[model samples]
Target: MEMTSRTKKFTYYRRKATNVIMLSSSFFSAIITIIPLFLVFYYTVREGLRYLNIDFFTKLPTPIGEPGGGMVNAIVGTLILIGIGGGIGIPVGMLSGIYLSEFGKNKFGTLVRFLADVLSGIPSIVVGVVAYTLVVLPMKHFSALAGGVALAILMIPTITRTTEEMINLVPHSYREAALALGIPKWKTILFIVLKTAWKGIATGVLLGLARAAGETAPLLFTALGNRFWSTNIFRPIASLTVFIYEYSKAPFKDWNEQAWTAALVLIMLISIVSLVFRLITRSKY
Candidate 1:
């Protein structure tokens, strides 16, 4: 009887020690992740805050050696490029995802998933090179269309994978219930399964867009860059990323300040998009 009590006590103490160790490890792991994030944020705000003003958003960028300028054209061009890319990518990605989740239990589906994974892993600069050859060579000029195409390619795999996972999370019973109610398979999938998973899919789409919006390498090869205002899809246009890259390297202190400010704007835009999508994905209705 005494031995049994001692054994029980020994087991309890051993479990308690393991739990304490695990808790301490997890606590430090979280701190390690969080500290760097705050440090970056703090550094960016400190450098960028001084240059963020009303004029920064409304006026066009000034010439080298000029006193005043803004990223108005770059901001507009970025929006236009993102819009074109999202328009092209979202539908195709969603359709591919639906097929993969609903009917991709065969060899063909396996091949498609493999290809998507491969495409996702390819360097963005390589994609930019491909787009430059395909789009710029044919068009004979750098253009926003090429930039849009590059961004779309980058977005597709992310959207496709996120969508497939979200759709699969919907219980099979939902599909079975719809079919039992005399609904056709197509209608059932379109109405029930799709509607149920739409919120999560939207989150994925937004995340993909956010990622595309921040890419610089692809735009460099495809859209190139314009310093002045440009709205045409067939013309080279200013991009926030390119502007930051150029300005941050200049000999002038003012241009360097502009780079930090542009970085802040890009960071805020990404943060907002991510937070919005996270909220949309988490909400239950």
Candidate 2:
């Protein structure tokens, strides 16, 4: 009896030790994963803070040799590009998602889902190339429109998948209840189902916009970057991403500092966009 008791005690302690070791390892792994993100945020703020000022938000880029300039044009252009991209992408993506969620239990729907997955996996630069061929080559010049098209394409797959998943999460019981009330299928989807899932759909839209905001490669081939202020969709436009890419590579100290400032501003812009949208879409209940 003593021998059996000793064996049981030993086994219990061994299991306890093993559990502690595993828990420690998991905690360590999480720390390792988070460290890099924290470091990047730290460094970006540290380096960018030196040059951030009101002028950076309000003035235009000065001549190359001059020291004082701002990225006003780039900021404005970025907003315009996002607006254009959203205008094209959001409706298409939301409609496609609705169709897939509501009536996509067939081969055609399967094909579309497959295509969206594949498109999501394709390189952003390749999408840039495609946009170039479709818009830039035909127009015979790079323009903000071409860049917007590329961003819209990139936004579509993510928005579509997110919308489908969010809508699907709406309970079947809710749909059935609405249908039994003699509501039309379209009305049920539009008013009953979609309303329930609007917050999730908004999150997805914001995510797509965030991803599109930082893209530099597509703008390289399509928008082609302007140095001055211009909002004409058919003309080249400055954007923060392209501005950062170009200035960061330049030998000038002032331009490099500006690049850091732009990076910081870009992050801030995304945060503001998210917060504003969240407030606008705040749940009433």
Cα RMSD for candidates in order: 3.8, 2.3
- lDDT by residue for model 2 (1-285), tens: 999999999999999999999999999999999999999889879888988999999999999898887999999999999989999999999999999999997999999999999999999999999999999999999999999999999999999999999999999999999999999999999999999999999999999999999999999989989989899999999999999999999999989988989999999999999999888888454
Q: Which candidate has the top score in lDDT? A: 2
lDDT of 1 by residue, 1-285 (tens): 999999999999999999999999999999999999999889879999978998989999888899778999998888888888899889889989999999998999989988988999999989899989989999999999999999999989988888898999999999999999999999998999989999889888988898888889999979998989999999998888988998988999999999989989999888987887777677765
Q: Which stretches of model 2 miss by more than 4 angstroms?
A: 1-22
For candidate 2, which ten residues in a row score worst on lDDT? 276-285
Q: How large an RMSD does model 2 have?
A: 2.3
> For each candidate, what is the lDDT?
0.90, 0.94
Model 2's lDDT to the true fold? 0.94
Record all residue pairs in model 1 with backbone atoms less than 3 Å apart, i.e. clashing: none
* Steric overlap count per candidate: 0, 0
What is the TM-score (0 to 1) of candidate 2?
A: 0.92
